[model samples]
Target: MDMLFSLMSPQVFLLSCMVALLAGVIKGMVGFAMPMILISGLSSLISPELALAGLILPTVLTNGWQALRQGHAAAWGSVKRFRVFLLVGLVALLISAQLVRVIPHWVMLLLIGGPVSVFSIIQLLGWQFRLPERGHGWVEAGIGGFAGFLGGMSGVWGPPTVLYLTALDTAKTEQMRIQGVIYGLGAVALFGAHIGSGVVRAETLPFSVALLVPALAGTWLGFQIQDRIDQVAFKKATLLILLIAALNLVRRALIG
Candidate 1:
């Protein structure tokens, strides 16, 4: 209450909660984009640093639920299957996170947003791509590195990860679980990295904690919707959302 108000006014707080709920719902349905939505929406109402801090806990917790929804065993399987990606991404994320204050925001946004938007548009136009049947390790490492680099700077890594998964033609349930595993681990690293970067401190901690209620509630609702959708519908929904998210990133870069 007092702590949350300290971060933003009551009206802003209300709007921020609404954004969190929306972000959570989308995350639940498609298994990504919470950070992009949170940073974009909350940054409009609050400082970017505070917005980054505010998203930390909710992203962490929601991703935890997403990762475990299928069971621990399945989540572990995803971890093992994508160990190279996870290792490279986490390492890159930790290293790039330290550069957050050094890099220009627009540069990072444009670099990630443009390619992702193009990729999504191509996919939506019925042009599909798949990873090579042999020797994909290098490809996974490259995409993971790119995702981690963007994630460390902006807290938005879903686009590239989603791109990689889509290229693999991953099944819906598996894709959801894999995203949770990837993002959940990455979120933990982000929490740690930002704490060291002084983005998440005592002052911003409460604001992050306060959003958990609405975020969780929205994710539960999204899960209900997700359960009702078939694989084709899920893929379409994911791509559409990805396209919108990518375009929003581009818009922010251009507008800012």
Candidate 2:
């Protein structure tokens, strides 16, 4: 207990717990957004690399649960279809992790936030856009590369994966499942990468473990609330959160 107390500052610990609570709730309701919520909130207190490392285990565990429970057979199909892209993306992430000490977080924020904002706006506006079928291999590779690179840097892998899944016109259940599986896989990759790169260290373990309690409690509460909310309303709330997250990234890039 004394050791754990020493690992985290009072304010930082409190804030981390609160963010974990909120992120857990959001993930419970929407089946995604853990990284976005946690990273955004934690950035105020911790370095971006530390924040990214902090999320690795919990996000993986949570999403692994969701993927197996909800995705089941459908998730396998997604894995099979996108295996090449996924592998390539993981490779990119591994390579980028080596550069954590050298690369600036602001560059990653701009890369991830800029595209996410533009894509989200276009999607929200209901624009009809389609990737060409003939060049899908190249497209997949490009997105996978970018996703891996940025994911390693900023812990924001959702936008590229989300965009790809959206373009595929995946059903709602499949969408959630695919996200869960991808996130779980990414978490595993990130764990290895970060550990090797020394981004996740013994000093951070206590804080990570402490934050999990609030995360679990919040997720349970969110699950209860999910049944009471309409789908449209839930979607709207998710969009709002996404907007806020994007704006926060931009602010961090430009001002911080």
lDDT of 2 at 228: 76
How do the residues 1-256 of candidate 1 rate in per-residue lDDT, one tens digit apiece? Answer: 7877876899999999999999999999989989989988998899888998999899999999999998999999999999999999999999999998899878887887899899988989999998864588999999999999889888888999999999988988999999999999999999999999999898899999989999999999999999999988998899899888788878988996
For candidate 2, write residues 1-256 as lDDT tens digits: 5665675578777888889999989887766778888888888877676677777777877778767764467678768878867888899988888887888878877777777777767767777456654458988888888888877766678778877766766555566677778887887898888889887888766666777778778767866776577755655555566666777788888898
Candidate 2 residue pairs that clash: none
Candidate 1 has an lDDT of 0.91
Cα displacement (Å) at residue 72, model 2: 4.1
After superposition, which runs of candidate 1 have C-alpha atoms over 4 Å from their true positions? Answer: none
Alpha carbon deviation, residue 45, candidate 1 (Å) = 0.9
